[model samples]
Target: MRHLYIHVPFCARRCSYCDFAIAVRKRVPAARYVETIRREHALRREREPGWDTPLDTLYLGGGTPSLLPPGDLADLVTTFALNSDAEVTLEANPDDVTLDAAAAWSSCGVTRVSLGVQSFHAAVLEWMHRTHDVAAAERAVETLRAAGIGEVSLDLIFALPAGMEHDFRRDLERAIRLAPDHLAVYGLSVEPRTPLARWVARGRTVLGDDEQFAHEFLLAHEILTEAGFDHYEVSNYARRLPQGGSRRARHNWAYWNDAAYAGLGPSAHGFAEGIRRWNVREWVAYERAVARGNDPIEGKERLTPAQRALERVYLGLRTVAGIPAADLANPSSSRSFLAATDAGWLTTRAGRVYATPSGWLMLDALAAALTTSPEGG
Candidate 1:
């Protein structure tokens, strides 16, 4: 595989809105986690032919990848056969960043760090159960710079509940002032069974409506683009270079382009040759499966032609590099193409149909309308 994603599921504390597969721990099991991953990789190498080949990108995403000790993190990255110029990314929390830790990460070949600075407001941070304060978040960015990391990406969450005290615009401005190389701006979703959902259900808090969500999304697009950041994907923006292109996240692009990637660790998903697979949801279950010399894959699906086509169109429309125009040659797509353009949802340029920020906010409905049929129905 050219790209690989290793999910590190250790977290110091679970964020209020988090429903991700994570094991909250007072003391992280760094060494044990690394050893488990090594075992899993070894097992995969035997079954998949090119699994051992050099990777173009390696993403260490997480509960908090930065929670691992620097030496342990280095060991995990070195375990992979990566291309010399491979883009290695680690997802970090602002409080976890230290100059020494960041320097060690760079020394071990981490070219990029994605900091989870959900919001710059202290109250919002506390409401979200984030471990760091605004000051720490700012310091983390400067520390990453001092460590000489090639790229720094900051994450922000907008469209919070009306009850929460936050100014989305101010947060955006603060993030821009920091001058991160990239930004991943996401809308706050009150996922089911999470603390946020419980609060909403009990009438303790209320999420914003679609209008608020749209407003915040558009506002981000305006501010970021005006600041010379390229809104390349639905929720991603990259700093545009003075001379030319933008500093896009290469690893994520692999997914947007439907390139096959291998995923390891609990709850990680992988897709190859039309088959999608995921590991066991719990860490203990995944570790046990690997220890027993069995594939940790809990289940897999081989998508049908129609399913694949719909997915292609859906994934394509989510990015700036949209699907080929010819892919939308169905009667349903052809009928709405003009209406969609007239509504300012998309634009056809250079033979590719690109979605505007507004269209991205309504990606699901738009993709469904434009999805092509396999049997020419």
Candidate 2:
């Protein structure tokens, strides 16, 4: 596999809306976590020859990969053989960024940093229980750039709970002023069993309606695109280079392109040779399994032809790179495509169907309509 993902599951505290697999700890077991990851890598390499190949991208994502010490980050990164031009990324909390930390990461070959700057509003940050404030978010970007990191990506959340007094447009403007290489703009979701869900269930708060979601989504598309960022993916935007190149997140592109990748660590999922596999979600169980020299895999699925075809349509529609018309050869899919195009939700150019900004707002429903229809697959 040319792409590798390592999930670091330790977090200082769980965010209000997060449903990710994370182990909350007052003090992270940095050394132990590093050792377990190393052992897991060695074991996998012994069994799978694919693990020996140099990686084109290495993404350290999680519960705050920046929480790890710089030395530990270096050690984990050094374990893999990476291509000279490989994209190495780390997901960091804004408060975790420091000049020293950023410099050390750059020295150790981390080319990009994705900062979790969910919002610039103080009230929203408090409600979300984020560890960083507005100032830290801006400082993080400056630190990354000052340390010579090649790319900086900022994440922003909109469509907050109703009556929260959030100014999403202000957040977008602030992000643009920072001039990040990429931006991942997302709508707040009340995941089941999360604190936000509990609040909704208990009538403590109300999530925004569909109208709010669409309005904010379209606003981001408008604001970011106008600022000269390319709307490359449904929820992602990249700064356009002077020569017309882009700073798109190459690692995530692998997923959109349906390429094989290797995933290591608890709750990490990997796809290869037509099979999709995932490891146990909890860190304790994962570490124990690895310690016992057993695969920590919780389950796997071998995708069928129909599933793959549906994925091709669904995933392709989420990107600016539209799918070929041939992929929708079925009569039902063709009809839906025509209807969507007429509704200003899609535009066909050069035999490929691309989703307009309005269409991306309804991406899930549109993709579902195409796939669920009779003969869709």
Candidate 3:
């Protein structure tokens, strides 16, 4: 199924760990950006001539998508042809969520809201340079659900700075109590050129080690599973309803499952057929490219069969859905998969394989091992 992703690169303030392409704007340039997105889409439509297929899922991800007024948000998403029952999602900052904004988004046809709470603890929020406090996070959840949003997804960062891990359980427990439809817990990482990295370089901040990360990651998985949440992806948990059904993040699942998707805006990535492309990283460059009526995509690579095979393994390993065993029937790949299972890094059930918790911890190494092609097919 075709998916549409609109990237909004505006944020209130740059987070310490954010290395994504973003511009902190005092006033969102919503109208101009939306126009650019449409222009670029037209160019792509001309280039392909067969992109009129309606999108199955539309995701508005960002710097902070909620920064857009609901009317503009609607204007942005309506640029595409979406399926009748498409899953439309918007990512919002916890501090920005209110009854009015949530209600506006719901009326705009957003099926899901992914709140960027970061952490429910004030200290942790402060360390992460998040604007929202514990109370605001709680209120965001309450107000959002009351606003009639069908799905509420909480974004939490675990394996925090030195002292925060001690109270991490409290944050997890509080999130569970909120009863969100989905939870995405990410283990913190210090990316290069970010404030957190500079702090570590200056010996001002000491990040957690692997064991610390493992502890908190396992804690979240265990607690959420006991609460009846499905560990559908390595870092995502989808809550099971009382009716015994679940709704996965359709947009992201498309990525993991290697489906073709189109992305708009700066630094957004898209893939169709075997080609993977991304727009320019800077706002200025992307604007200039789009203004010229040419593709803002600065780079693209066509994947070979082996490369796609490796990607399938890598993406599959990062989720509950493992790659087909037949995909690794080659001698080297089969040996690697067998070795991974022997070391308790993977498990097989029915016709599929799943990553164990330990496997998730060493996921990269495991995927590489499982995709090691011997010469050619």
Candidate 4:
């Protein structure tokens, strides 16, 4: 099955910690971006003729997808043969969700709304440089529900430099009170070149230490799980059985499964036919390429078997499904598997290995250990 992703690269303002390829400008080039996406889509269809394969999921993620004009957003929906039962999701920010906007999105086949409600605490929101206030987030959720959108997910951030244990717990409690179907909780990471990094470098901000973050992370996990949320992925929790117990964000799952997907728009990435390609990061360059009837893809990589295997382990380990036991039995991997199991971070039952809650926190280390050969040899 194929999944599709369309990137909307315009945001009103960049958050302090955001590192995604986004352009924050006063005026958004909605029309130009839509045209380029269509051109890219047409070119991809001509090469693969795979549009007929009903798309199981269509995700419109971005700088802020809700920033797009209603008409432009609807045009994107019309461009794809989204399966009748497709999980059409739109990633939106709280400030962008209006009653009219929510209705417009629902009319265009958006079945799920992922709202960016980083924090309900005003101080924390300000610290993170978010544009919306706590009230705006509440209104956004109410608006989506009022617009008849049943599946709502909220995105949250914790371990802010200004956050405390009580503050983190309060955020989780407030989010749960809103009753969203899913919650995407993330720990703040200071990416190089981001404002957060600059603040840390200049001693303007002091992030929570590793121990503090670990405590908060464990606390949030416990709280959410006790509240009946499934810690399906390290950072994501959902109440319902993921469109009927299917194991993940379908669009993202495609990447882990190494399935074909066509990513459209500037800075988007596509993987198909064993080749990975990415578009230019600048909108001007992307538009120019599309205007010239060129593919606009700036670079491509052909995956080696070793690279693909490494990717499988890397992605598989991040989810609750864990990696297959057979994949871990190679002589090179057996030692790390046994060590991790012994350490209580992983367990094997009925031939499938799964990570415990503690293991999820150190997933990267576990994955590295599993993929590495024993001994420096």
Q: Roughly what TM-score does model 2 have, to 2 decimal places?
A: 0.98
Pairs of residues clashing in candidate 3: none
List clash counts for every candidate, in order.
0, 0, 0, 1
Candidate 3: where are CA atoms >4 Å away? 330-335, 373-377
User: Best to worst by lDDT, what's the order?
Assistant: 2, 1, 3, 4
Where is model 3 poorest over a 10-residue stretch in terms of lDDT? 368-377
Candidates sorted by TM-score, best first: 2, 1, 3, 4
Estimated TM-score for each candidate: 0.97, 0.98, 0.95, 0.93
Those runs of model 1 whose alpha carbons end farther than 4 Å from true positions after fitting are 330-333, 372-377
Candidate 3: clashing residue pairs, number: 0
lDDT of each: 0.91, 0.91, 0.85, 0.81
Best by TM-score: 2
Judge candidate 1 at residue 166 and give its lDDT: 84
Q: Model 4, range 159-262, lDDT digits (tens) per residue?
A: 77853333888899999999888888898899999998998999888888888778878888899988878887878887755456622466665676667887
Error of 1 at 226 (Å): 0.3
